[model samples]
Target: MKLREALALAIGGDLAHLAEVARQLSSLGVRVEPGGDVVWGPTRLLGKGNNGVVVFCRSRHGDIYACKIRRGDAQRPHLLDEARYLQIANGVGVGPRLYAYTRDVLVMEYVEGTPVADWWRAAGAEERARFVADLLRQARALDLAGISHGELSRPGKHVLVARGGRAVILDFESARPGAQNVTQAANLLRALGLTPPLEALRRYAERRDDLAFNELLSSLLGQLKR
Candidate 1:
């Protein structure tokens, strides 16, 4: 389906309202990418959630982005808030790069990778170790930035393990202040069958300094080696 049609379906309104929406999108310099047909229902989409749906888009410059659009029934204009949190995460190197956003739309980097679940199972020991370490750094970054991902303990499909073993944490829609990112990530590590480095993690949580972080990394890496 066409981008306008798909967006109209996701966010139904009067004809005039829809036309205005199209104008806003056009002014933002984005449109559906050719040959990109990822879909869930009638709409060509990258992903969908309760608040919004994501579609693949191309800038006039032809760079691909994941455009998040607010669903019709969603609480209005949450993408702006999501974009802000994502920008904070981007500053700390924890989430996808946010490019631009309006009340109903968000444009951000498109991550091509496997969910951590599938990726972990296929990754070799060293790869798994590297993935864990990357996630730890990202988690620590969020912790230090004081933004909790809000669902990291039940990470679900939130962490994307891309090529070269970088683990990109996704969906800052639920991110909030007063983070416990490292603690939640340790819980995730436990769920993934690694022993949590409790004492080291606690020390890192208390200090959040380089020495504490290095000790925690060493502890986690030793578990992977065993």
Candidate 2:
């Protein structure tokens, strides 16, 4: 299915929105095979949510991107807010690089890797400990930026581990700003069975106190190193 056809299928009964979506995709020079089971524009379907279907796409220059298209009205009605949050996440290097986002579509750099749970399951003892530590750093970054990833507590589908062991957090549609950033730290402890409140981690990031942060991280890593 080309962009036009895909838009038609996604927007179903709404032909006007369909045309607009097609136009938006064309403006971005995106070509997709939505009819395919697992592929689109030299990329593949990474995941799909009530919000939209996330497909992998490639540019003429051979750059890979993740494209998310709204599902009709979308279960989450705040596409713009999600896009804004994505920009915030990008600012802190916490999520994928966002290319563009419209009322019904979003395009960003494709993060390649396994999910965090899968990665943790396959990692060696030392590697698992290191990965968790890196995850804490990312969470701290988000807290420092005043952005809270509301989904970290159940990050099974929102976190990805790149080939080089880089942890890439995803989906900022539910993020919020406020004090007491403990979701990331608490989530990691529950998911990884390691205990350490994230409050200290957030303070370490806000104060830019690297020595203390490293010391804390090292101490935690020691307990987890196995």
Candidate 3:
């Protein structure tokens, strides 16, 4: 089925609202990539979550993007609101680069990467140290930006580790005003059995400065180095 055919099922809106969704896509000059994989969730979707259904779409200039369409029953069914939060995350170089957004749809950079857990398991000690350091750096960035990821404590599927070992955090639906990202990310580090005490990493959050975080990072790196 094509995007429109799939939309009626994905978005539980009435006929007019559905028509508007189609209109919006066309007016914005997006070319939907009809063919999709059936993995990651039900149907031929790229992925699905509480707030939206993600699909691949290309621009007129041939730039591919991930499109998130809001669900009718979504608790926070405002794609634009999510876009705003995502933009804040992007301000600090955190989330996928947001391109354009309407109330029902958000177009963003398509990250071609493997999930962090899958990548982390196969990486060596050096690679693991590199990833841990970068993740902590990003968590520190998010903390300074004041955007709490809300779900990083168990971020198994929330992080994508791409080629060249760059780790990109995904899914900002649970983000809010207060940020505890460093603390939460430390939770992930603990889960990975990275040998850092949460209490120590927790201090980095309190410092809110590069010197303190880097000192902690140096300590972690010292242990990671063999």
Candidate 4:
């Protein structure tokens, strides 16, 4: 089935779920216009994940926003978690600003940028290393703040290389509190097929020096074998 058709079916058939979402949106001061076939003009589908669907929409105020709509009743908690995480992540330079959210719908500042994986594929090794280092810095900040993005390892989850060299992390549905910074960094590296640069990251965390960071990363990569 077509993607739009599938979304319509899910929204229409699930009245209770829709009502809950509407209630949440209302509480957040977002106006939900009533109509049959509510279509935002020419919405581009970015991608879909196990937790929710993401679509780019031009808001009534002429601002572009990434609208993430969750799929089922079971997914509601994840949406709520994302809302909570965004509250902490606002202005952190790690993720998008949470503009609005309901039980099933989330509106966020749309980050126009290439995914880190794609950027890394086209980038030279030095640029990729820099990107990795910058990501680690952002992760450390979140860790210091006691926030854990539960799905940080997913490829496409971290949107980078935005306008003006800004990187923004997206998709926080599974994010929680109280996760180890080192473990999260390890998992992200493993997912990217890079040896977990634990030692380098540790050095950077300790002394905030790039050269020491690279040496530590080399040592950590060596340790990953055994």
Per-prediction RMSD in angstroms?
2.5, 4.3, 2.2, 6.3
Stretches > 4 Å off in candidate 4: 1-6, 10-13, 19-44, 158-160, 190-194, 197-226
TM, every model: 0.86, 0.78, 0.89, 0.69
TM-score of structure candidate 3: 0.89
In candidate 2 the C-alpha lDDT for residue 16 amounts to 66
Model 4: clashing residue pairs? 200-216, 200-217
Tell how far residue 66 is off in model 2, in angstroms. Answer: 0.6
Candidate 3 residue 97 C-alpha distance from true site, Å: 0.4
Give me the overall lDDT of model 4.
0.62
Per-prediction tally of clashes: 0, 0, 0, 2
In model 2, the clashing pairs are none
Angstrom error at residue 37, model 2: 8.7
* Tens-digit per-residue lDDT, 1-226, candidate 3: 5546665787666787777777778877786675445343224776778877788898989888888877767777477767888898899888789988888888888988777777878888888888888888888888888888888877456887878788788888888877688777777776776666555666666776777678767777777776
Write the number of the candidate with greater TM-score, choosing between 1 and 3. 3
* Model 1 residue-pair collision total: 0
Error of 2 at 57 (Å): 2.3
Candidates sorted on lDDT, descending: 1, 3, 2, 4
Candidate with more favorable, higher TM-score: 3 or 4: 3
Candidate 3 local lDDT, residue 17:
72
Off by over 4 Å in 2: 1-13, 33-44, 75-78, 179-182, 197-219
lDDT of 3 at 165: 80
TM-score leader: 3
Candidate scoring better on lDDT of 2 and 3: 3
